[model samples]
Target: MDPAVARNLKRRVAAALHRQISDEQRATATDPDQAGLRQRGRALIEEEVARWSEDYSLAHGVPPTREQDRALAEAVYDLLFRAGRLQPYLDDPEVENIVANGCDDVWISRADEPLRRVPPIAESDDELVELLQDLARRHGGGERLLSTAHPTLALRLEGGMRLQALMAVTPRPYVAIRRHRVASATLGDMVRLGAVDATLAAFLAACIRARKNVMVTGTQGVGKTSLLRALAAEIPPHERIGTLETEYELWLHELGRLHQVVPMEAREGNGERGPDGRAAGEISIGDLIPHALRMTLNRIIVGEVRSSEVVPMLRVMTNGEGGSMCTLHARTPHMIVDRIAELCLEYGPRMTDALAYRLTANALDFVVHLTMVDETGVGGRRHRFVSHVLEVAGLGEGGRPAMNEVFAPRDGEPRGVPRTPPSCLDDLRRAGFDPRLLDSPHGSWSAPLQLQVDGRGPGRRPDPHANGREGGAR
Candidate 1:
């Protein structure tokens, strides 16, 4: 009823409301009493607004009870700091990705199968933009709409998080956040999610520790990054690691390195960073690969080797100066090597067939093929997320690339685990694993019923119990 009292009420409600909004945006908890205060304060503002509207209507000789002007002012202030800005699941440790299809739809995926659609917390498009901008700033640099240029731009947040946002014309804007803290994921964590079992886990550890060059191939979001992160965790603590990525995605920096993770980011052009903060001059990742040679690093990691970077990466692998590891987007490990060969013709014209084969066999000591399989072979699979870890044996007579069925659960059933290829086991043995060592409790190659028969068709499953034939723990 009183104008002065209404003014005080508006100011108090706005301040408390703004603070509550800030807490929510930062993923922090707010006080319950604060909410109650906001409600009571708003009621006081509404009464004042009504008086203001009535007086104006009388002055204008119009009958009016609604305070449209005061209502507008209060609405602006209240909406500015709403709880719509907060996204708790984005910061959740279990959530791997946050996908949004415009302001109306949002979804999240965990390592385990379960894609859940979320309810819209934003009341309007402007509210959505406010929240997204705040998120961007907290992660690092915030996002904005460019009227002169493209209205959309994706970015990598500090500590290698991923963020994408789009400006809107009518409907709400779209935003998706992918937060991966490049930390070395533990094998136990992978096992818990069924990404890889114990036997394959041990084999992968040995492969990395032995300085074997490995190519991990998989489709996008098929846990390719997860598998890569898990393997990066396996890199020996004593060695130096150099990693190059389009955008820094690997967390190898925290691990051992004569130890350096040289992360190469993509510029506006199809090249890498320059000495300057801007992307004028393009520094190729292929060129950066050679720098690892001068660093005396034991292991070189390329976050994901694309076209031209592949050959140079392999060259370093074959030169005997370093072990190469990178993730590539592909359905199978066989396709990974093939793609590299095609890339070689593009990057390494001097490479011959024989030389390429020798170099490939020499450079790539192993290929860990990772693929996601649905739970139901036919349909109706709900919790249908499982990663199949396959290993590469070597070049077959096919002259293309050959893969050994190293790790796949039979009928997709969780059996004992999959056994390591005898080749890997033999290599481990020659490095001094006694034949009897496997029978000993803690032996690296020791595991029972882990290798299940494929029985899908005609195939030979290596007998880890027999002598090291294609058959031995020999």
Candidate 2:
């Protein structure tokens, strides 16, 4: 077929589809049938494809092959019902993230591959920004906008894809789409993924079942959210779980038929500051925490804690029912206490460091620290693993959080070992977990503290994972 004729046919088909969609919407305005509208739109696109393909074949003195027909249908369908130029990457199961750096330069991160460049998703920056704005309008409740006035848009699409865009805030319009790779994860599935060994998986599952307060700590893209989801699955089906997040990233409501889930997302005000210089109608995790608590929930899950919400989260974990979980960014397991203190002071109540330590010690029970290592030789991908599981022991000298190293990574091994007994021995047993697993010397691996390079030991050297491996995986 001729390229000029093909372009003309595409434009004509798109225009026809637009008109048909408008007509369908108008017809359905009084019906309140959303499924019917979608079905009509789909049928219209298909009928147009078949008619146009046949017309082109007859006029060009050639019959269209199966592949050509299929291609035409897909192209038309993308323009009609899907993200125009970015549909292919969205359909790929392995693509974990799609990053658009302006319009001409696009990149993607696959499950087992390094970040690599991809074909442009748009013809120009203006087109890219328009695409994002359209998405926000259609699927995101039309509350957020991407323009010089708002300059930022963040929302979850209908397909559960999390999108964040920056317009005038940056030199160029930037967009990022983070897809949840593991839609429905379980502890057993995570074990198969090499995220955690069978022992750790079993223990974490038991912890959840026993209604222990837990926090997953890690840097960015280290599978903290993944582990948190896997752990959340251990809660009994009869339990009512409430999840709160800045964006609805957990998708906990989709956790099958057994559990009752209440999902809440923080609403960003329309960038309107009132007389007090604060955005009016802005709702924070702090606001949602009390609301979730009043819902008679058996458990509460915060997708991630980034600010003053830590204060309310700690209060809930301590005073509210057990089994509350959240994730945060921290470099190491030991540093998480300090990290919580810093975030609380910055965003939450203006409390002294001593009060922060005391509150954490009383509220949080365990911290599961995760790390990602560049294992090109092993898997040709960055492998995220649980590096430490610390039990909060009372405040130690200088009001620092004292912790018991229950699980820590050892030399020459990817998984960490159980170094100490769990504080909740009776609870684990009641939850059907064998306490003997914690009693066994974990593979004869040396304790994490003793493995330090500067520590005195017979022939122990520094563990590379512990020594300045920051930014190892993104």
Best by lDDT: 2
Error of 1 at 106 (Å): 2.5
lDDT (CA) for every model shown? Answer: 0.56, 0.76
Which residue pairs show collisions in model 1?
Answer: 240-257, 240-258, 467-472, 468-472
Can you give the lDDT of residue 425 in candidate 2? 72
Lowest lDDT block of 10, candidate 1: 139-148
In candidate 1 the C-alpha lDDT for residue 117 amounts to: 89
lDDT of candidate 2 over 1-474, digit per residue (tens): 332333344456657656776786698865525575556656765676678778878899887887876676665555445665787888888888889889888999888677799987776798778678767665543376678988988888656678889988799988888887877778888877777766788788888888899999998778878788889888888999999988877777976833699988888777789996767778877789989988999888999999888988999998977999999999877789889999889753558898889989998889999987764443345767787889887788888778988888654444577788866778888988877777644432232322212234455545535644322211
lDDT digits (tens) for residues 1-474 of candidate 1: 332333344556556656766676578565446456557556655555566577767889885534646554455334333213233564467676776666558787665446688765455565566556544333322222222134454566544566677774424577666766335566666665555545556666666666677777777656556667777777656666677765556656654432445545443332333576434454557767777678777777777777767777888887754456887777754466666676666665686565556557667766666665443333223221233444455567856455555554443243323433446677645444343432322223332222223344444344544533222331
Which pairs clash inside model 2? Answer: 308-347, 308-348
For model 2, state the Cα shift of residue 406 in Å: 0.4
What is the TM-score of each predicted model, taking all chains together?
A: 0.60, 0.83
